[model samples]
Target chain A: MKVASIGLGLIGGSFALALQEHVLEVEIWGIDHNQAHIEAALARKIIHHKGSIDDLKNFDLIVLSIPVDAASALLPEILHQAEKECLVIDMGSTKNDVCEAVKNHVKRNQFLALHPIAGTEFSGPKAAFASLFNNAMMIVCEAEKTDENLKKKAYQILQKLKMQLHFMSPKEHDKHLAYVSHLSHVSSFMLGKTVLDLEKNEGEIFNLAGSGFESTVRLAKSNSKTWIAIFKQNKAEVLTSLKEYQQNLKEFEKLLETNQFSELENLLNSTSRIKEILAKK
Target chain B: MKVASIGLGLIGGSFALALQEHVLEVEIWGIDHNQAHIEAALARKIIHHKGSIDDLKNFDLIVLSIPVDAASALLPEILHQAEKECLVIDMGSTKNDVCEAVKNHVKRNQFLALHPIAGTEFSGPKAAFASLFNNAMMIVCEAEKTDENLKKKAYQILQKLKMQLHFMSPKEHDKHLAYVSHLSHVSSFMLGKTVLDLEKNEGEIFNLAGSGFESTVRLAKSNSKTWIAIFKQNKAEVLTSLKEYQQNLKEFEKLLETNQFSELENLLNSTSRIKEILAKK
Candidate 1:
């Protein structure tokens, strides 16, 4: 199988590496806008060749793993360039815009919208690895719109990577992700901001930070370029989730201000269900 | 060494177990208001004997590891009961209140104010482990107030457990902890509350929650009893940190709402310093 791995960053590079590990006769061609990333990916042997959008028809598969905005912008052109038998899949975080971008394209059936829910705070080719997607959830949006043969091919590859697949509409995918994923990044970023602001005044404050603070702020280290595009594309949903989060925080603060200890305990106890949910996950 | 481990919960039980592992010829006497906790500690071999606070004079050391409010409430009595050679150390999260509680006690010189910056969300004796304190930070507050001989003994035990020690005033400890520790809990709990509230209406929302959400919300599962007491004792400082956090969140929300993408990116990038801080930690 010949695969075009676009945007040779963490996600794209990791996908290429995973494909090479799982597929017996796979060849990955790297295509990245950033020259450094391409060189890094090549040096790491993540891709067999450096390729471009012009050569899309020669490949059996094309994987898009750029920031959400770029993926949405280039997806239609990618699908248009692909051969009738070729499948183009986008692994962007937000799905609705990308799905809508190719909705009316003549080769819409050649496109698959996928979001493998996996990543780290770090980014770029240097951070990529073959096992990044193992045991991770892969949300495939609007799978029915894709050609059945192409969908089957994508499923085979995903299964080989040991990823669990779930299907949803682009709208449902974005909405759920706003609550579960995007909001988490915002919360973590703000937590980091708050602590960083105070750390400037109290130089040794971080010495007291324990595992909880580290875990809570871990996502604050995510690449700003990627997250800015994601936040912009999913602005409405993110704003909604952020508002709800602020409201919840306000309620907690008010309970504490009023010295209502029992109510405060009740609030905390209710959220403790996340333990069981995460355990199940 | 004859040691009395007061309040055999996660912290107390773990301290007892660590002492048994680190100190030669040591016998741990467990004392807890909860009979189940004492039995669980004894069964897990976290403690060797069941004893009461009244017999504190017989022990060479007394370790108090309970909720901050309870620790603050009982420190004077515990110190009064300890013999001159008995070093009484309270391993509570908040320090100022506990330090104040024992300030005028006749046995004040025997008491040490310590906060071990280590724990998991899980609580109770069952979660206790001897290695919990290994390589963790142990903050010693007002060490000068404790008897020199007792402080030396406590330092020896802390070193044997592989804990790094830092000394600061009790007020400084509480103020810094409010920003780095207590505020992180509030942020995490609110994040969990927000997501859980949404999940109630959107039944499958959690299916999309990834490692990011799990990490940011991990502290939501922390024991309500322990946190309520910490927040109560450190209310002034916690409230200050929490307000700053809320302000930061509001500013980020405004930037997003106004389409100030560059400012949003800058904010995220600036806070990314936490990555280095945590790595250093």
Candidate 2:
């Protein structure tokens, strides 16, 4: 089988590597607009060859692993040109926009909207790892719109990659992702902003940053281009989460102002439920 | 030398372990109001023996690794009864209140206020590790209030543990820590709250929680009691930082509302400087 992956950066590059490692007799082809990323992916041996859309006719599958906004804009064209039996899957962060945009495409049944809920803060081809998706959840959205054989193939691919699969609608995926994924990036970015703005003395921040601060602010290093696209794609849900988050902050501020140590402690205790939630997962 | 560490939980248990590993021929004693903690510490072999305040008189060094409020209330009494040359030090998250409470004590010169900028979200004796302080910063505040020889001994001990030493005034340390440490806990706790509120469907959040959310919300699992004391001790500084963070969020929200993607992009881009700042450390 030949697998062609577009936008061969972190997610795509990792997918290409996973295919190479796990699948027998699989040849991986890569497509990326960024010349540097393509070269990096090639040098890193993440792909067997670099391919163009013109080569889409020869591949068994094409995976779109770009930003959501870019994926939404490009999916129709890619779907229009791909062969009827070819499987096209996207590993974009947001799904509803892409699904809506390609709903009417002639080859829409060939496309599967998937979000492999796995990533590191680092990006680019160099950040790809073979075990990046191990034991991670992969959410497949709008599966009803996809062809049965393609869905089976996609599930087999994810299973061989050692990912647990879950299914949901594109609308549900977007809302939940805004809370769990997109909001985290914003919170981290804002935290970095808050700390940077308050501490004019850079030396102090560097000197005093412990593992807690490092872990909490780790996602602040995420690429702005990708995050902006995610935020824009999931704007309404993101906005709602942001409002609640800001309100939580304000409530915490009021507690601090009144020296309500008990209330503050109670509020913090409520969030400790994440430990149980995370532990179960 | 005999070392007694009060409050044998996370910081104290780790410090006792560090003493066993680093300080040659030292006898370590554990003290905690929680009988279970004391029993757990002994069972885990985190300390050489269990003791009470009666054993405090026999130790060459006495370490206070309790919550800030408890430390503030206990330090003066501990100082009043400690030997003339006994080195008393604390490992609280906040420094100002504890430093001030012991400022005019008769044994002020024998007391040292230290905040080791190291910890994980997990706590208790089981969480103790021998190399917890390795390559981490130990901030010593108000060094002038400490006896020269005692301060030297404290520095020597911390150095023996392989921690880098940073000296700052208590006020400066509290202000800086509010940004780097305290604010991170609050941000993480609130991020957890926001996600937990929105992710009412358990399976969705479990499936969708990528590394981004996990990293950003990791600190929310920190001990509530310890953080409440920190928030109370550094209330003013925390409030200031919280307000600034709220303002930044509001600005970002306005940008989203106005479809000002460029401004939002710039905001995220500017905050990415934290990567460099953290990288330097």
Candidate 3:
């Protein structure tokens, strides 16, 4: 199968590598706005050739791996330019805006809105690796909207990459991701901001930074172009999640203020149930 | 030199294992408030024997590995009970309260306040492992308060464990830790609470849990006894950090509400500096 991977950053680049590793016959074409990313991905052999949306008609599969805003804008046009049998898939973090934008389009069936639940605190084609999707989830939102044959083909290719398929609606994907993915980024960013803002002598004091602080704030390192688009697209659900998170933080502070050690322990114990929930999964 | 590890949980048990691995002849006498923990550590050979504060006088080194509250409550008595040559060291997360409690004691010079900046979300003897302290930071607070000879011995032992030693005052340690260690736990716990509380069908929705969310919320699994004591002991600084964090979240919320994508991107870009800070360390 011939494939064109858009964006050429962490997710897109890694997808290209993983796809190439899993299926030897699969040919990946690189499409990225950044010339450096295109050059790096090409140098790394992450793709067979550099291509534009105009050239997408030559491929059987086109993966949209760009930022949500860019992907949302390009999806309809890409679908319009694609062969009727072409399977167009998205690997964006948020789903609502992009999915809704192309929902009523004439060639909508050619595009499958999907998110591969895998990444690291790094970016660029240089950050790409072959096993990024190994043992991770590939969330397919609005799968019913795609052609059955195309969905099956996409599933088989993802299965080859060792990803667990999770089905959800575009609405469900946006809501759950706001709580699960987007909110965590918000939490991590604020954590990094809080520490950096509080410490004026960042270089000296960062030596005092431990693994817990580092892990909790790691998502704060995410690129602005990608994440800013996600935050804007999933605005409402993200707002709700933040409010609930702030309320919890306020309550925790109150417990400390009142010297309610017992209550604080109970709260912490309740929260610790996340360990079991996470472990079981 | 003989060592008594006073808590058979993650930190204490791991400390014993790391010490035993580094120094084949070092004897670790285990002490714990939980009889089960003592038995478990003994069976695992994490300790040479199950001992107590009463047995501390017989050892050349007394390692206080208990929770902050228990360690805070016991430090004065442990120092008083310890032999003059026995150096008492603490591995508690927070230090100011414990240090202040014994500042006026006659045997204060024998006690050195220290924190190993290492741990997992898991707890107990089974979770303990050798090399846990390897390539990790060990903060020795108020080292000047301890006898110079005892401090040297402690430094040599930590060096054997392959840890980097950082010296700071008890006040500085507590304040800095409030921003670095303690605040991150609060962030993780509140994030877990926010998600758990909002999701009614948590077990079903948790299937959506990704690595990003899991990593950000991992500290929520920390044992309650250890963290409650930390929050209570360092209440003021934790509260200050929480307030600052909440303020940042509110500003971020407003940015999203007003469609101020540029400002949001700038904030995220600035916070991305955490990547550089963490990488250097």
Candidate 4:
């Protein structure tokens, strides 16, 4: 099987590496508008060859692993030109926008909207690794709109890469992801900005920052272009989650103002449930 | 030299283990209100023996590794009973209150206010480890209030344990810590609460949670009792930092609501400075 991957950055490059590592008799062709990324992907041996959108007509699979906006913009064009039996999958953080944009296309049934729930703080071709998707959840949204064979093909591919498959509506996925993933990035970025603004002395920041701060602020280093697109595409849900988070912070502030130690204790106790939720994973 | 550690839980137990690991001639005696913790510390080989506050006169050094409230409440009594030549130190989050509470004590010169910027999400005797302080920061506040010779002894001990020493005023330490450490914990706890509230299906949370969520929310599992005391002790600074964080979130929300992608991109880009700061450390 031949896989033509768009974007050829972190997610795409990593997926190409995973395919090379896990699948038998498979070749990956990389595509990206960023010439530097394509060059780096080639130099890093992230793909077997560099290809273009025109190559989509011949590949067995075409993976859209670009920014959400770029994916939404380019997907319909790829759908129009792809072969009937070819399986096109998008590995975007926000699924609803892209799914809606391509809903009425003639080749819509050939496309599968997927979100592989995995990543690290690093990005670009150099950050790609062979085991990026191992044991990670791969969400397939609006599967009813996809052809049976195409859906099966996507699932088989994910399974071969050692990913757990999940099914949910695009709307549900967007909402939940806003709370769990998108909001985390926003919170971390803002936390980084807050600390950086206060601690002008970089030496102090380096010396005084412990693991807790490092862990919480790790996502602050994520790609701005990718995150802006995510926040824009999932605006409403992200806004709602942000409001709730701010309210929680305000309540904590009020408790502190009143010196209500027990109330603060209760809040911390209530939120400690994350341990169980995360541990079960 | 002999050491008596009050509150033989995570921090105290870890310190005791470090003493055993680093200093061959030093003996550690555990003192805690909870008899079970003392037994567990002994069973875990965290300490050589068990003792009470009455034994303060016997030990060459006294380490207070309790909650901020307990440290403030017990410092005077412990100082009043300790030998003049003995060195007393605390490993609490806040330094101002502890230092002030003992400022007028007759044995105040023998007391040292230290905050070791090291910990894990886990607590209790089981969480204790000899290498907890390796490459971590040790902040010593108001060193002038400490006897010069005793301060030298404390510095020698911390230096032997391979920790970087930073000196700052208690107010500066509290202000900076509120932004770097306390604010991170609050954001993490609130994030955990927000996600848990939205994710009614525990199975979905367990399945969909990725490394991003795990790292950002790691501190949400911290001990509620210890954190509540810390929040109360550093209430003002925490409230100020929380307000700044909420403002940043609100700005991002506005950017999202208005489809100001550039603004969002710029904010995220600016916040990426955390990478440089962390990399330097």
Candidate 1, backbone clash total: 0
After superposing candidate 2, which stretches have Cα over 4 Å from the reference? B201-204
Flag clash pairs in model 4.
Answer: none
CAPRI class assigned to model 3:
high
What TM-score fits each model?
A: 0.98, 0.97, 0.96, 0.97
Residue-level lDDT of model 1, residues A159-245, one tens digit each, is 999999999998888888998889989988988998888887888788888999999999998999999999999999999999999
Clash pairs, candidate 3, are: none
Any idea what lDDT model 4 has?
0.88
TM-score of chain A of each: 0.98, 0.97, 0.96, 0.97
In model 2 chain B, the worst 10-residue window by lDDT is B198-207
**Candidates, DockQ:** 0.86, 0.83, 0.82, 0.83
By DockQ rank, best first, the candidates go: 1, 2, 4, 3
> Model 4: what TM-score?
0.97
- Cα error, residue B168 of model 2, in Å, equals 0.4
Please list, in the order the candidates appear, how each scores on TM-score for chain B only: 0.98, 0.97, 0.96, 0.97
Of the candidates shown, which would achieve the greatest DockQ relative to the real structure? 1
State the displacement of the C-alpha of residue A140, model 3, in Å, after optimal TM-score superposition: 1.6
Which sections of candidate 1 miss by over 4 Å?
none
Q: Candidate 4, fnat value? A: 0.87
* Per-residue lDDT of candidate 2, residues B30-104 (tens digit): 888889998899998898788886557867999999989999999998888788879999999888999889877
Retained native contacts per candidate, as fractions?
Answer: 0.87, 0.89, 0.84, 0.87
lDDT tens per residue, model 3, B1-281: 78888888988999999888887588888988788999999999999887866756778888888889888898888888888789999999888899999999999999999998888888999899987899999998888889999888889888889999998888888888889989999999989988898677644677887888988998888887888888888888889888999999999999999999899888888887788788887
